[model samples]
Target: MVRARMSPRVRQLALIGLLLAGIGLVVIGIIDPGAPAVADVQPPAQPGTAKLAPHLFEGPDGPETLPLDGAFIANVWLQGCQDCMPSFEAWKRLYEAGEIPKSLPIVNIAYGEVDPAWAERYALHDTLLVDSDGSKLVKPQAITTFTTLVVAADRKIVWRGLPRDPGYLDQLKSALAALPKD
Candidate 1:
């Protein structure tokens, strides 16, 4: 039997289509194709709101003091939490944004036993306080997962929550913004 021949134009189009399809698939994969179609993950907290940082958690990061006032953010996080790692990134964004006053600190009260070297994950080892023992600073009711506290210069509590909490950063920023303009 004789075989049919395809035109050069058709072949070129097919090749081009295949190439484009491959590129598209790659892009999707890199962008997390397996991620839910909808926004399943809640966004990070905003800059202004109630904060949760109660006391200090001693760690290798020196002494991370929770923000009490003067336009600052206070985050309480553990060193080895997978979830806190990402939130720590978010904290970087918030700090780099120049919204937090220099005096305002991001205190990570690390509970449980952990290595001091982990403080570098959040770039806070030199600038924050670590309270290994939450017995004194953290209240029985204030305890939570990756808790973050946003306090204004007036010593007001605006935001608080774990990394997964909605609007966690917002409460932080809001509290900072509400500070008494230094």
Candidate 2:
């Protein structure tokens, strides 16, 4: 049987193409590592009662177990998470404009190696809570890029969701209004 064999030049070109394709795949993986196979599971799917376990979170004045004796807004985020920054900025603006009640405390819970400068930069120096061990207060899988929880004095989560979610502002306003005045 007579068979046509690939020339040396053709064989070299094929090997080069395969090598280039492999390199391209590696570059793509490095650039965008994509989401995890298992998605994070958020807690208290709907607004419900849940307690904040006493956790030693580093603050401006060093570590302390925050006293949840009153209604407050908990802003949970991961360090170096770019998507979480906008939510923090929006909350800051609302607080500065007096849109958020002066009496309500906004606690910023950071999961990961906390950067001290972040507190000052975000104007959250007084309320920053650093969860250095990430999973102390809440499981790692439960904490997403950003999660906002409006908890009443009784440890009931009145509203919980992403800050960018639709009706977020309206729901937040309603939750604040529903909270008992001190």
Candidate 3:
């Protein structure tokens, strides 16, 4: 058997190559983290009219309608969607940082039957609208992607897209800032 040892220069080159490869992987992962397992539904086109169906959610107060009289943030998600985690984190951070207004409503719509315990475990504490069968609100919205829509008081979608996108968040901030104070 023959034993071979690489020169110091060769070993350093190999180590540097591995380090570069690792950094590249990290960068790629950060740039496009991709989406969660999305439902097989078609999203409505951009600038489409948006309206919250009457009595869409049954809250503690009773059957409720989404307030269309002010700018609000609506996050649409499905149960067990792994990709929604980033969106959740982004919103949480924004909330903690006070980037999201305390007065502005953060509406979370669960597209399917979600356990109350599941929500508690996930810390989905918001004004939740449960669309357990996708009949009332989900189907009507034609929601597809894991989306966060900034809706104006007039039922116009001012900004619509992923909640985790940095650019989207910036756009959201700008849109919210432009909304007339109630």
Candidate 4:
């Protein structure tokens, strides 16, 4: 049996409907592209977890390996990610708000082609570690996205994710409070 052909007006309406739906989706993505999806945070890495190799940066005199001997916040960023810039700004606000503890330092690990000049424009001039090898250090550390990791003194990944989540500041405060005295 032959199928009934739809009228020209009906087809045009359907096409317009599909186009509108696509535009809506684009708008939603622009409004709130959420955190990168990654596996559940693994258990705190053993004290002997492999460490990052030494790497060069704009200011340092030579290749310097990030010392793995203390708790720190690693904010991994990429030059191309649309969300990365805003995320950096958000973290900066948190830092300026004094939410970050005085004892814990925040470091930015530029995992890709992040120019030092461009990063500095975003106020990322301090404690920046350039890793142009595309996450060789972060991947081995089991980090799977552009988020922050709360690392323990022993180089263990104590906690990892967006600190903007509700109650996260409190959690961070508690974690820092619980760090073992050496």
Model 3 gets an lDDT of: 0.69
Model 4: pairs clashing at backbone N, Cα or C within 3 Å: none
How many steric clashes does model 2 contain? 0
Identify the candidate with maximal TM-score: 2
What would the per-residue lDDT of candidate 1 be over residues 21-130, giving only the tens digit for each residue?
A: 99987998898664333344444344343344444444443544454445555566657767666676766665567644455655545655555566664555544454
lDDT of 2 by residue, 3-54 (tens): 9999999999999999999998788778755533344445444566566666
* RMSD of model 3 against the true structure: 11.0
Least accurate 10 contiguous residues by lDDT in model 2: 35-44
Candidate 2 ranges with C-alpha deviation above 4 Å: 1-44, 138-141, 180-182
Pairing residues by index, what is the TM-score of model 4? 0.60
In order, candidate lDDTs are 0.57, 0.71, 0.69, 0.64
Look at candidate 2 and give me any clashing residue pairs.
Answer: none
* Residue lDDT tens for model 3, 1-182: 99899999999999999999999878867874442224644566465365554555755456666775677877777767778777767766766676665558877777776665665554455776777666665665677546777777776676777767878767877777877676
Minimal lDDT window, size 10, model 3: 32-41
Better of 2 and 4 by TM-score: 2
Return the lDDT, model 2, position 74.
Answer: 81
Alpha-carbon deviation at 91 in model 3, angstroms: 2.1
TM-score on alpha carbons, each prediction: 0.49, 0.67, 0.63, 0.60
Candidate 1 Cα misplacement greater than 4 A, ranges: 1-71, 82-86, 92-103, 161-167
